[model samples]
Target: MTVPTLSALATQLTSYNPDSLSVADAQQLIRDYVQATDSSETVGLNDALCRVLSEDVISPINVPAHDNSAMDGYAFRGSDLGVEAVMFKVVGTAFAGHKHEGPVNTGECVRIMTGAVMPADCDTVVPQELVTSASEASMTLAPGVVRPGDNRRLKGEDLMAGKSALRKGKTLHAADLGLLASLGIGQIPVQRRLRVAVFSTGDELRNIGEHLDEGCIYDSNRYTIRAMLTRLGCDVLDMGIVKDDRESLEAALRTACESADAIVTSGGVSVGEADFTREMMAKLGEVAFWKLAMRPGRPMAFGRIASNGKSAYLFGLPGNPVAVMVTFYFFARDALLRMMGGTKDSTPLIQAASQTAIRKKPGRTEYQRGILSMDANGNPQVRVTGSQGSGILRSMSEANCMIILHHEQGNVNAGDPVNVVLFDGLC
Candidate 1:
C-alpha cells in the first residue's frame, strides 16, 4: 500500500492547520494515514491471547455435533403430552457420550442424562424434577408442565458447520480462545505483534538508579510508556533516555526508524531552548509540529520518519509526565493499534455526573484525572483528582477515569453531565 505524505493528508483535511490543530482533526489525520501491517503468523490457541486475527475462523463442524438433552430428564415425543396426567414407560437409559441403541416409540421414553443425545422420535424432554411421580419402570408428568422442545438442545444450535465463528481484525481474548477451542481449532493465524521503540528526551532527565543532580528528575515517561505498550501486546524496544542534543537525538531516531514500526518520544516537542527532539525528527522524517487545541498536551509532533530507506511513524509527545500519558492515550494509542493490525478500537466514553463544579474554557479540550464511583443511587459520579497539573503523575495514578471537557464546552456546574473514559477499559 502507498503511504500518503503529511502534506497530502493535510490537503485532504480542509481544517488542517498543523500549528493550531484540533484534537479531532489530529486524530483523523493519523487514522487516515496509518494502515495495518499485513504480516501474520500462526499461533497456538493458548498463545493467541490479545493478538489480532488475520483471517476469519470457520467452524468445521457443528458445535454440539448432534441433537442432545439439555438436562437429566425423560425424552419422549411431544405429541404424547395431553391435558391430563400422562405416564411414560421408561424403555432405556442414556448417558452422556452414550447413545440409546433403539428408537423411542409412542408412550415410551428414555431416561437421558445431560448432554446425552436425544433418541430419534423424541422432540421434548421433561426434567427429572418436573416429573410428578416415578416408579421402577415408568414416570408420570403433570399436565401443562412443559411445552414441545423444552429442555432439548438442537444440533448446530450454538454454532453451525462451515460458519464463521470469529471475524478477521478481532483482538483475541480468553473467551475467544474458548470459542476457537469449541470449534476444534488448535492453531490460527494472527497478525504479528507491533514493534514500538520508546524513549524520553531531556538533558536533565536521569534514568532510575542514577543519582539525580540538582534540578534534574528521573525519567518516568519511558517506564509508563513501556507499561502501556505491554498492555497493548506490543513488542517494546526501550531505547532509554536520549540527551537534549542534535547528534544523540538524530542517532536515536534513525535507529528506531530502522528497527521498529513506530517510535514514541516524550519531551522536546514543546518550544524550549534545549529541545532538540523536534529538530531531529524534522531532519530525519517528514514530521509535523502542532499546537493542539487541548490542555496539558498542546504541543506535539507527528508524521512518518525515515532512516536508511526504512520508515516508521513518530509521535513526539509533551515533556510533562501527565501530558505524555494523556496524549498517548488519546492519540498515539489508536494509531499504534491500527499499525498492530487491529480494527478501530476506540475506548468508549460514558456520561457521568460531576460531583463538583469545574472551571473550564471553551476552545480547547481538557482531560482531567478523576475518581469515578457509584452514588447512593448507583449512578456513576466523578470528581477530579486533586491538582490537575500536567506534571502531577500522582493524579493519574489516583484516577480511575478521565473526565473529558470537550472543545466548545463551557464550565461544568455541580451535578451536570460530563463525558468520562475509564482507565480500566483503555487497555
Candidate 2:
C-alpha cells in the first residue's frame, strides 16, 4: 500500500493548519499518511505473542477431525428416548484417545469418556452423573435428562477446513496460540518489530546522575518515553539529551532519520525563543507545526524527514512532563502502531459517572487524570486528581484512567457521564 504524503493528507483534513486543527483531524491525518512496514518473517508459535500477522491464516484441516463425546456419559440413539425412565445395554467402554468400533443397535449404548470419538449410530449422550441406576452391562437414565444431539461435539465445530481463522494485521495473544495449535500450525509469518529513536532537547535538562546546576532539571521525558515505547514492543534508541543549539539539534535529527523508522523528541516544538527544534525540522524535511486545540499538549510537530536518502516519520512533542506523555499516548501511539502493521485503533472509551462537578471550557479538548473506583452502589465513578497542571507528572502515575473531555464539550456536573480510557486490561 502507498503511504500518503503529508501534503496529500493535509488537504483532506477539515482544518490542516495548526491554528485551526481539531483532535479528530490530527488523528485522521496520521491514519491517512502512515502505512504498514513491508518486512516480515516466520516464527515459531512460542515467539509470536504480540507480533502482528502478515497474512491471513486459513485452517488446513477440520478441528477435532471427527465427532467426539463432550462428556463422560452413555452414548445412545436420540430416537429411543421416551417420557419414562429407560435402560440400555452397555455394549462397550470408550476411553479418551480410543474409540468404540462396534455398531450400537436398538436399546444399546456405549460408556464414553470425554474427548472419545462418538459411535457411528449414537446421536446424544446422558452424563454419567444423571443416570438413575447402573450395572456392569446396563444403565438407566431418568426422563427429560437430555435432548437430541446434546453433549455431542460435531466435527469441525471449532474451526472448519479451508476457512479463515485469523486475519492479517492481527496482534497475536495467548488464546490465539491455542487456536493455532488446534489447527496444527507450528510456525507463522509475522511483521518485524518497529524501531523508534527517542530523545529530549533542552538546555536546562541534565542526566539523572549529574549535579543540579542553578536552573537545570533532571531529564525525565526521555526515560518516560523510552519505557512507554518498550512496553509497546518497539526497539528503542535513546539519543540522550541534545543540547539546545542548532548544530547539535541538526546532528541528532539526521542520525535518527537514518537509523529509525520513527523519531520522537520532547522540549523543542513549542513557541519559546530557544525552541530551535522546529527550525531544524523545517530545514531537513517537510513538517507541519501545529497548535493543537487541546489542553496540556497544544504545541506539536508532525511530518516526515529524510537524511542521506533514508526517511522517517517525526513526532515533536511538548516540553512539560505530563504534556509529553499525553501527546505520545493520544497521537504518536496510533502512528507507531500503524507503522508496525497493526490495524487496530485506540482502545475503546468507557463511560462512567463523575463524582464531582468538573470545570471545563467548550473550545479545546481536555485530558484530565482520573481515578476510577466503585461507588456506594457498585457503579464505576471517576474523579479528577488534584491540580490539573501540565507539569504534574504525579497525576498520571497516581491515576488509573484519563478522563477525555471532547473538543465541543462544556462543563460536567456531578453525576454526569464522562468518557474515559483505561490504562490496564486483562491479558
Candidate 3:
C-alpha cells in the first residue's frame, strides 16, 4: 500500500488551514498518512504479552481432543434411560488422563471423573451429587434427571482442528497465551516493538537532581511521555532535555530521527519569542504547525522528519503539563499503535452524566480532567477536578477520566449526558 503525504491527506479534507484546524481533521490526516511497520519477529509465549500478532494462529489439534466427562459422575448409555427411575450397575472407574477401556453394556455405567474420557457407548453423565441411592456397586437416577449428552463435553467444542484460534492483528493478553499453550504452541509471530524517541525542550526547564534557578522548574513532560510509551509496549529512547537553541534542537531532532521511528517533543511547538521548534521542524522535513480549536492543547505539530536520509514521524506537543498528556492520549496514542501494527484504536469513549453544569463554549473542544465515579443508581457520573488549567499537573493525577466536550457542543446542564474517555488503561 502506498503511503500518502501530509499535504495530499490535507487536500482530501473539506478545509485545510494549518493556522486553525479542528481536532477531528488533524486526527484523520494522521491516520491516513501513517502506515504500520511490515517487520515482524518470532517470540516465545512468555515474552509475547501485549504484542500484536502478525498472523493467525491455527489450532493444531481439537480442543478437549475427544468426548469427555465434564463432571465427576456416572457415564451411561442414554438409550437405557426411561421415564421412571433407572438403576445402573457400576462396572468400572474412569479418571482424568486415563480413558475407560471396558465395554459398557445396557443397565451398566462407569464411574467418571471430571475431564475423563467417556466409554465408547456412553453418551450421558449424571453428576455424582444428583444421584439417589448411590453405592459403590450401583446408583439410581430419577426420571428427567439429565438429558442425553448432559455433562458431557463434545470433541472440538471449544476450538476445532485446522481452525483459526486467534486472528491476525490481535493484541495478545494473558488468556490468549493460555489458549496457545493449550494447543502446545510455544512461539508466535508478533510485530516488532515500536522505537520512539522522547525529549523536552525549554531554556527554563531543569532536569531532576539539578539545582533549580530562581525561575526555573523541573522537567516533567519527558517522564510522563516515557511512562505512557512504556504502557503501549514501545521501546522508548529518552533523549533527555534539549536546550532552547537552534543548533541544540536541530541536533536532537536529527539524532532522534536516525535512531527512532517517531520523535515526541514538548514546549517548543507553541509560538513564543524563544520557541524554535516550529522553524526547525519546517527546516528538517514536512511538518504542519496548527492552532487547534481545542482547549488546553491548541498549539500542535505533526508530520514526518528526515535526518541523514533516515526519517521518522514527529509529534510536537504543547508545553503545558496537562496539555502534553491530553494531546498524547487523544492523538499520539492511536498513531503509535497503528505504526506498531496494532489494530486497536485509542481507549474508547463512554457516556456519563455531568455532576454539575459545566461552562463550555461552542466551536472549540475541551478536555477537562475529571473524577469519574458511580452514583447511587450505579451509573457513571463525572465532575471536574477543581481547576482546569493547562499548566496545573495536579489535576491530571487526581483525575481518573477526561470529560470531552466536542467541537460544536455548548454548555452542559447538571444532568446532561457527555462523552468521557477513561484514563485507567490508556494513561
Best by lDDT: 3
lDDT of 2 by residue, 124-217 (tens): 9889999999987999988899998999999999889999999998888899999999999989999988889999999999999899999999
TM-score of candidate 1 to 2 decimals: 0.96
* Candidate 1 residue-wise lDDT, 225-272, digit = tens: 989988888999999989888888889999999999999999998888
What is the lDDT for 267 in model 1?
A: 94
Write down the TM-score for model 3: 0.95
Candidate 1, position 306, lDDT: 92
Clashing pairs in 2: none
After aligning candidate 2 to the native by TM-score, how far in Å is the CA of 116 from where it should be? Answer: 2.0
Span of ten consecutive residues with least summed lDDT in model 3: 340-349
User: Which 10 consecutive positions of candidate 2 have the poorest summed lDDT?
Assistant: 418-427
- Candidate 1 Cα outliers beyond 4 Å, as residue runs: none
Q: What is the lDDT of candidate 3?
A: 0.93
Candidate 3 lDDT over 42-124, as tens digits, reads 99999999899999999999998999999999999999989999999999999999988979999999999999998989999
The ten-residue window of minimal lDDT in model 1 covers 280-289
Please report how far candidate 3 places residue 7 from its true position, in Å.
Answer: 0.8
lDDT score, candidate 1, position 91 = 95
